[model samples]
Target: MLSNTDIAELLARQAERESGILSRAFRRAARSAFLWPEEVANVIAQNRSLTELRAIGPFIERQIRHWIDKPPHSTHRAPTIRRDFVSLAKARQLLARKPAWAKILRGDLQMHTRWSDGSGTIAEMADAATDRSYEYIAITDHSKGLKIAGGIDEQALKKQGNEIGKLNAFLRKSGRNLLVLRSVEMNLNRRGEGDMSPESLLALDLVLGSFHSSLRIVEDQTNRYLAALRNPHIQILGHPRGRIYNFRIGLSADWPRVFAEATSLNKAMEVDCYPDRQDLNIDLLKIAREHGTHISLGTDAHHPWQLEFIELGLAAALKAKLPADRIVNFMPIGELKSWVREVRGRAPRRP
Candidate 1:
C-alpha cells in the first residue's frame, strides 16, 4: 500500500538511523542542497526493512570517511549477557562459534539513563547502542515513586519526552539504525501496584511494571501480582517473581496460575536477564514455553551499557531449548504491536 517514494523515505530514515557517519555526511551534503549522493547507501541499509533486517547482508557496508566537527563525548556501550554456562572471560569465544547467539544479543533492547539512574543521558545511551549495531532502544527511566532514582513527575514527563524526541532526531541525523521509544520502568510499590496512574501509564510508548520493594511479602504477593496483570498498561510483568539468584529472597510465584493468567490475559512474563539477579528461572521459562505464554526477555538494565543482556536470555532459552516462535517481544515490531493490541481489552489468550 506504500508508494515507492514512501518506501525510499522510510529506507532513508532507516539507513540514516543505522549509520551515523553516513547520516552526518548525507545531512551535511544535504545542507548544501536538498539531497546527497550518500543517500544511496541509506537505501541499501533500508534493504533490511523489507527482509526484517536479514536483508542487510554484511557485504553491503559502505565505508564513509568523516571527521566530527564536534566529536561525541562517549560511545554507546554494548551489554553482553554471558551464557550462564560460560564465564565472562570465555563468552566471546563461545559467542564466536555460535552465530545464532550473536543475533540474540543484537536484538532490540530497553535501558535506563541518568534521566533516571543511568550513567548518561538518553542521547548518549542511544548513540552507544547504535554503535553496537542494535536495531532499537527504549528509554525507560524510572517513573515517580523511587525518588532516589530521580523518578519523573508529570511536568518532568513532558520534558523527558521532549528530550527523547531530540535524541531520536539526533539518531535521524546520524542515519544510523536506531529507534527511540518513550517508556518507563514503573515500580510495583508496597501494595504490589504500579506507581503510575492509568493516565500516566498510557502516555508511554512502552511500559514495564517492576517490583523493587516489599518482595518479601509471601502472603499478598500473588494477589498483588494479579493486580498488576489485570492492568492493560502493565505489559510485561518485570521479573515476575523478584528473585535474586541464591542470595536474597524471591517472590513465591504460583506458576500454573501465573502462566495461565499470562496466556489468558495476553500479559507477558518477563525473563529479566540481569546476572546474580535473574528472576523467572529456567524452570519457569520451560513452563512458559510449554504453555504457549508469550515471553519477553528484558535487561532491566539500570545503566545504558547493560542493554545487551539478551545473551543471558538466549543462554537461558537455549538451556531450556526454547524455539524462536514463542518469543513475543522479539517478534517484528508490527506483529508485537498487534499481539499487544489483542491482549488489551480481551479475555486471557488461554485458560
Candidate 2:
C-alpha cells in the first residue's frame, strides 16, 4: 500500500517532470505531505475527502485517489534534499508507542512573536502554551541582523522583554502554570559571531544562535560549528544544519567533531520541529546521541497552533535513543533555568 512518504516522493517526481501551475501544485502537495496527520491510504480506507489534507485540491485529489486505488510498485527513494524527514503521521505513531516520553517535555524552547515575523501576539502565544500546559517557552524571535525576517534590535528586544515581563506577571496572577522566557534567535556571521551586542544578550534568559547567511556553501563547516559552540553568549545552536527540504541541503560538517564540540561546551543543538526545517535530522542526531550532546526541541513556531510540531522532534529524539536527561526540554522549570544560568556562568566575561 502507498504511504504518505511514497505519495510525497511520487508528487515530487511529478513536479520535476512537469512545469508551471501543475508542477507547482505537485510540489506544494509534496511538501504538505509531511504535515498531513494521516496516511492518504488510511484516509481513503475511511472514505474521507482528500481535500481535507493541506495543499490538496480536486485535481491533485483525483490523481492521489487513483494512486491509492491502484498502489504503485517500485517507488523510488526520496532524493537527498527530501530525504530522512519524518511525516507528522509517522511521528505520532512513533510517539504513541511510548506515551511517557512526550509527557516529559516541560516546555518549548524556540518560538516567534509579533516582535518579529510571527503572526501571534505574546498573549496569544501564552494562551496556546497554557492550553498545552507548558511550564515555560522561549520567545526566540529573530535578531536585528536578519532583516528579511523582521528581526528585532536591542532596543526592540528591551521593549519585548518588558512585554514578556508583563505577560509572565499576568500568568502568575491568573494562576497559570506557564512562563514565557525572554530569548532571541540571534543570527551568526560566518565567523560564528553574533549580530546582537553581547551586553544586550546578557538580559535574555536563553540564547539560540543560528546562521542565516552563506548557507549554500558545500564546504565543511566544522570550524564554523565549533566557533558557534564556543560562543559564550550562545547556549543552543538552532537548526544546526540549516537544511530546508527540497530547497537547500544545508552546510556540510564533520558530524562527530561538531557534536563533540557542543558536548564539551555543554551547549545544545536544536531539532527545529517546523515540518520543513527538521534540521539535525535523525542521522546527525544519532551522532549527537553518541557524543552525549544536549538536545533542545523547538517548534520554531510562527503561530500558536504550530506548537504541535514539537512532536516531530520528540519522535526524532526517541528514535535516536537520546537519553531523557540530555534533553533540555525534559528538565523541570527550575532545573532548566539553572542549566541556562550555569551555561552563562561558564562564559568568559567580555572586557
Candidate 3:
C-alpha cells in the first residue's frame, strides 16, 4: 500500500512531468499531502471522495487513486528540498505510539495574530489554544522589518501588548489557564542581526529571530548561526535553515559548531512546524541532541487552526530522542518563563 509519503512523491514527480496549470495543481497537492490528516489510501478504503482533502480536485484525486491502485515498483528518494518532512498522518502515528511524549507539551512558542498578516485575532488564537489545553502561546507577529507581511512597528508592538494585557486579565478573571505572550518574529539580516530595537524587544516575554533575506546563499553559514545566537535580544532562532518544501534548499552550516554555540549560550533553536517549512528537521535535531542543545517547537501558525501543526515538530523531537527536559514546550508555564529569563540573563550585557 502506498503511504501518503509515497503518494506525495509520485505527485511531485508528476508535477515535474507536466506543464502550466496542471503542473501547479500537482505541485500544490504534493505540498498539501503533509497536512492531510489521513492517508489517501485510507480515505479511499472508507469510500470517501478524495476531493475532501485540501488542494485535491477530481483530476488530482483521480491521479492519486491511480497511484494507489498500482503502487510504484520503485520511487526514488526525495531530493533534499522535499526530504525529511513528516506528514500529519505519520506524525499522528508516531505520537500515538508514544502518547506520553505529546502529553508533556505545555504550550506553543510561536504564532501570529491580526497584529500582522495572520487571519485570526488574538482572542481567537487564545481560544484555539484553550481548546488544545495549551497553557500558553506566543504571539510572534512579524516585526516592522518584514514590511511585506504587515510587520508592526514599536508603537504597534506596545499597542498589541495592551490588547494582550486586557486579554490576559480577562482570562485570569475567567479562570482560564492560558497566557498570551507578547513577542515578535523579528526579521534578521544576512549577518544574523535583528531588525527590531532592543528597547522594543525588552518588553516581550521572549524573542524569536530569523533570517528572511539571502536565504539562497550557497556558502556555509556557521558564522551567521553564531551571530544570531549571540544576539542579546533573541532567545530562539526561528526556522534556522530558512528552507521551504520543493523550493529553496536553505543555508548550510557546520552543524556541530552551530549546535555547540547555541548550547553554550543557553539559547534555543526552533523546529518551525509549518507544513512546508519544518526547518531544523529530524537530522539536525539529532545533532542538537548530541550537544544537549535547547529545542523549541513552534507552529509558525498564521491562523488559529494551524496550532495542530505542533505534532510535526513534537514527533520530530521524539524521533530525534531529545531529552524531554531539554524541550522548552514541555516545561510548565512558570518554568518556561524561567528558562527564558535564564537565557536572557546569560546574554552578553549590551552598552
Candidate 4:
C-alpha cells in the first residue's frame, strides 16, 4: 500500500536521475497548460516544458510507449507508414532481409539448438546467431514446473551449465566471440511468486518470470509482480500478465506503482513478443515508459523462428513512441550485462 506522498517522493528522487533535456522540458511544460492534446503537442514540438508552457495543458496519457499507425497489410505490394522519421516501407525492407538468427547486439549471447525446443545444439544456436551477428544468447531451459515441456530442475540446470562450459571452450579454441548463459524461464505460481525458489533463482545468469497460471485474479495482480520483484534472485519479470487472446487479463493493479518499484530496485520487465498472449498490454507499457522503467522484449520464443519477434516488437515500441535506448533489447552488450549484474549481483560469470 504505497501512499501518494510515497509515490511523489520516489518520483522526486528519480527526477534527479533524469537527463538534463528531460528535466528542463518537463518543467517548462508543467506550467500554464490546459488539458488539450494539441496544446501539449505544441509544447513538445516547440521545446517547452509543462511548467513553462503557455498553459498547464491537458496531461496527455499514453496507453503505450508510443503510438503506431502500422502499414496496412498488402499481399502483392509492400506496406508503408512513417516510423521514427523513416518510411515504414523502407524500415520494413531493411529488416526483412536480416537473417532470422540476427540479433541487435553481440557478446553475452546464447541460444538453444535441437537439444531443447529449437533446431540446434548449444554450439549450433550460437553459430547461427553469430552468423546473423549477436554477442550472447542465454540458454534458458524450461524449469521443473513445466513438466510437459521438458522442464529442468537442479540436476538438469547443472548439466546445462556444464554443457555451456564445453561450448565456450569449443568457441574459444577458434577465437570466436560468444558466451553461453545458463538461465531459466520461471513461472508465476499461485502464491504470486515465480516457479523456482529465490535461492535456486540466484544461481542462473538470468531468470525470466512469467505468469503461466493464476492470471485471472486481476485485483492482486500488480502486488503479485511487486512481490516477485522483492525477490533479488528474479532478474527479469517476463510477460507480467498472463493474457492470451480470447482471454485477456483485463488490466489489473497499480501499474505506476509496479513500474516504480521495479525501476527503484533496478529490475527488468518483459515485453514478450508473443502476439497471441500480449500480456503486458500497451497501457502498462506506457506506464513503464513514463516511469522510466527498463523493458526487456522477449519472443517468449518456443521455436527458433519466434526470435523474429524483435522486428515485430519494434513496431510496438514505435507505436508507443518509446525511445529505443529505453529497451533492453536495444542496449549494448556491456550495458545489458551491467544491468543484469546489478539486479542479481551475480557476475564474473563462469567461463
lDDT of each: 0.60, 0.93, 0.93, 0.55
In model 2, which residue pairs have backbone atoms overlapping below 3 Å?
none
Worst 10 residues of 2 by lDDT: 68-77
Model 4 per-residue lDDT at 130: 66
lDDT of 4: 0.55
- Clash tally for model 2: 0
Model 2, stretches more than 4 Å misplaced? none
TM-score of decoy 2:
0.99
List model 4 lDDT by residue over 107-187, tens digit each: 322233444455556666677556646566777666778666666677767777788888889887988876667777766
- Work out how many backbone clashes candidate 4 has: 41
Encode model 2's per-residue lDDT on 1-351: one tens digit a residue: 887888888899889999999999999999999999988888888989999999999999999988877777767788899999999999999999999999999999999998899999989988999899899999999999999999999999999999999999999999999999999999999899998988889999999999999999998999999999999999999999999989999999998999998998899999999998998899999999999999999999999999999999999999999999999999998898899999989899767
What TM-score does structure 4 among the candidates reach? 0.64
Per-residue lDDT of model 1, residues 102-221, tens digit only: 575434435678777778777777766777777666677777887888887766777888887887787788787677777787877755567777666667666777877777766636
Q: For every model shown, what is its TM-score relative to the native structure?
A: 0.68, 0.99, 0.98, 0.64
Off by over 4 Å in 3: none
Query: Could you tell me how far off, in angstroms, the CA of residue 34 lies in candidate 2 after the best superposition?
Result: 0.6
Q: What's the lDDT for candidate 1?
A: 0.60
